[model samples]
Target: MSSLTKNLDAIRQNNKIGHFRYTIGVTLFGMQLINYFDRVNLSTAGPSMMSYFHMSSTEFGIVSSAFTWTYMIMQIPSGLILDKIGVKWVSRVSSALWAIPTFLTAFVSGLGPLILLRVLLGVVEAPNTPAGSKAAGYWFPLRERGLATALYDSGTKFANVIGVPVCAFLVLHYGWQSAFFFTAIMSVIFSLWYWIIYRNPRESSHLSKAELEYIEQGGAQEDAQPEPGVNLWFVLRQRKMWGLMLGNFAYNYATFMFLTWLPSFFVKTLNLDIQQSGFMTAIPWLFGFIAEIIVGGWFVDHLIKRGLDASKVRKTTIVIGLSMGIALVGAAYSPSVWIAVIWFTIALTGVCVSAAGFWAIPSIIAPTGLVGVVSSTMNVSGMIAAIITPIITGAAVDATGSFATAFILIGVVLVLGVFGILVLMGPIEQMHPERNDSNATISR
Candidate 1:
């Protein structure tokens, strides 16, 4: 009878759901949603804003790329800040502060002021990706990390799906400035909500002891502190880090190009008006969002839980998904609007699906208590590409009077990324800071 009682207790304990973690995941989703909304609005407003300021495509691209200049510079520092400070406060302060620049964009009258606000926006928003990574590492087990990462990362796609149309409506009815105001309001509200609700698993009153055990036993990084003796140079010296950086740079280049120029592509290249461009832009992203959640997030996690080799699964997904970026070539030469949308949708869906695996890699691979540093380091490479993609794309469009060359450039970059992943990202596993043996080297 005692043995039977013990078995039942074990079963019950295993079944505890720990509902609050999902709440945190959902909150992370909200933050990303708000982040991208602010970003895409500037692009959605591009045609109107350009016309208002008498700016050319190259000039507008400069404004779009301005955000990344500061963003790239701050990525590592933001990660270190999160490592020293906790996610709750870092997130709270960043969210509240980002809204100020987003709001002030509505009042800027010239290109200089507009550019300055964008740079400020980047400064404040730099912590978001690293913070999401840190929080996911803290709140989820290994098997669930992909889905948890997707839960927040997919918000980028969802924002494009919903935010484009909403911003278009605002831009059409009131003015382009209204879009900024709306996103800023959402950002402020989310800041307050996040402050009131978020806590590390150990500190949360809501997490049951059984659920907490399940999390820690399943390999959640619950402690929100950095390990001693780990330095930035130590992380930078890893070959695996460079591979992750290259992969991320390829992914981010394509993403930043699309974010800053997709609407304009519809407007200038496809000859669609703002409303048509807005709705059309939403279609590919809507599909991307759905794929991100289902294939990237849920399906990947489901496979890992079923005893598949986790590293193999993630690497396969990353390679295949990034390879899909080649479809941009097809989109570039597409003969009709529908055909173009179909191509872009295919490319973005692949990108989103792969993102589920790639973003989760930081948590899986970081040395103990250094997920933030690793994540930020990886992000810095991506931001370098992000900083330049818009400007380059704009120059290509202006020089050739077509977007074909720009799309081809992105496709080539992605192919290089796939090679980097295959050659340098040797395995998906944690690193030990104390290991001095060459065998302990993961990618090398």
Candidate 2:
């Protein structure tokens, strides 16, 4: 047999599962769920938070923007840190640290302190996504990474689906503070549990030889170890990297604006009561969760089966999803609340469809072992947009006394995002020239 066939056999032999890998994936997914719940609880509690603090629309915007601002700034450094120290300690520490501020938000009395707490929360939580991406990159093989990333990313939407209703209930019965406190405690508990349970795959004794072989044979070379030096300048100079980064930014500009402001829009503009608003706010995200799971897995598999190039399949999905997101602006202008909700749900479903495809690109295109850095870079751009869009939307609302202008602005950005994906991203296999044909087959 040829050397390539022999290598494939060895990899397959190693790709077997034991109990430990399953535990790690579960723990990581839980952490992601809590991470999202903490970020979004503020949205569910927006009305009460406004009432409790007597905050203006602009003040609330600033408060919400604090998390994204800090999270954005920390993204690259967090990725670098993960690369150097590995994910185990960093993930646990960041998770535990973020929970402190989440718990303390219950005690905040004024806008100033609440904003400060959010900033702290952002700082601590900055590492969560990068750490999870790094862990996935390290543990899973190419074929599995898309589903892994989707499962992890879906935690965000799932948390929104569940946490919105739960938080709304807590705020109505106990108080807004109770919502924060509950989520905070859950985060802390999970952080500790994760630390106790997780082990790096290299160090894991329970992994079956078959599983290890599968990953190795799947072109996931362990030799691509994290280097001590990473040149941000070099990373930035790559046009393809910039394409991914900017594409991510455009995608998030609309998403964060919707996530941060949608609840308030329902209450203030649509005249829904808080409970009704919360349920309505959750509809888009619930649909988005389902879309991500189905599209992220099924779409790629279908493209591969049809003999489409992996890069083209990925880019096509992104273009379709982003173009669909532009419809959200029309949702904003709808005369009826139900119509608006339907439009919003459809738009977000599009975003979710694209999201899984977009995330899979990095894993497929990135140089071996650079998935963490690349993923972090792309997410940092998205977080930066997340930081600014809320504040800008607030200013727009303040200026116009309506969310219509803000929604339109976000829609335009989403349209631009479509172009970014189509023009800038080029081909997904460019970064891994040696394994191009092999990856294409697996993708198929």
Candidate 3:
């Protein structure tokens, strides 16, 4: 009998291999938690850090934006490298690269070194999101990808929820430096864990033959091998490429607003102390975390399985999520501080509800061997906004002494994002010359 046949029989007979896939997905999720923990820790430390360096608000914003400068530029190259080297090496090396800078962040003596280290942090961490997205695409089949993607993407929200409170405690006691030291330790630990546990389905010795066969038939790219002389120009030519990139800018504008400034917002606008602000920031992000994993990922998969067209289902869900993001503006207009947070909670939920679907799009539609490129291209928007928003918001706030203009600008961006996805993103399918449908056909 063929090895495939024999493996199928073993899978049918063995219970141990039945859910190895979940284990892998969860491990990826852990990596995200670690990745985002590093990002959020700085925010929890911001009030203290700003004072230590005698930094102006705009200068702090510049410091925040510094990380994304190289990070944004590196996305295309990072994606290509992940595709070439495979997720394993790229992920491990990138984590270590970022971890070193993260550890050194504890020692930054001035704004110059701080910004330099942040830039290094950005370059190394740039590969992470695309790599994680690739992990979802490669490991999970179409039916399960929504939740699978959610599982990993939710790590960012979870980091805010958990990382905020924990970092606040450390900042309150051991000092802000300890928070950096702690997250750095976790990154090193995750690198070792990821190396041992994660492997493509075909490369995994522990995965059942039955599970591998199931994944292949259901659209998981069991063979992620690139074709010789693969044409990336073709990927760049598709309208979906532009749509995804533009849409991401909108999604991330609001995300970075919260990630970089929410703690400061609580302190400055709401009159909360550092500890109160850190804990409060956790509340809205918790709503986001729950929505991403439960509402966005799991519910999307459920809808797709219930006979929805994969194309229409994902798009419609993402649109609704984007529209709900407008609620973020309401927070600025609220009468009470807690009331503003309530509005933020609702707005974050709306945004995160699209998280799984957004991550799933490239994996769902991108040509095999090019998922990394496509995913990376789409993710460049987030980096660009990360670079722009902090600096812009900080400058705007410094000039006005209020966050109202920044909030209104964010609302406008989210609206444009809705347009990008609705009008530009085409049917959820692979891009190829043989396909009869053109981008115009999917514009509706």
lDDT values for all models: 0.86, 0.77, 0.84
Q: Write model 2 residue lDDT over 1-444, tens digit each, in one string.
A: 445446655555554444354466667778888998887789889889989899888888888889887888888888767766778888878877877899889998888899999998889998888777767666666555566667777787788788888888898889899899989888878878987777777676766777766655555535255433434444555667777877788888888876788888888889987778889988998999988877875666556545566677778878888888888888767899899999999888888778777667655665655666677788998998888888899899899998888988888888778777776666776364333343222232
lDDT of 1 at 115: 97
Clash-forming residue pairs, model 1: none
Q: Model 3, stretches more than 4 Å misplaced?
A: 1-17, 225-230, 436-444
Taking the tens digit of each residue's C-alpha lDDT, what string does model 1 give over 387-412?
89999999999999999999999999
TM-score of 2: 0.91
Off by over 4 Å in 1: 1-15, 224-228, 434-444
Worst 10 residues of 3 by lDDT: 435-444
Candidate 3, residues 219-250, lDDT tens digits: the string is: 78544665554546667767877887788899
Report lDDT (Cα) of residue 32, candidate 2: 81
Clashes of each: 0, 16, 0
**Best first by TM-score, ranked:** 1, 3, 2
Which pairs in model 3 have colliding backbones? Answer: none
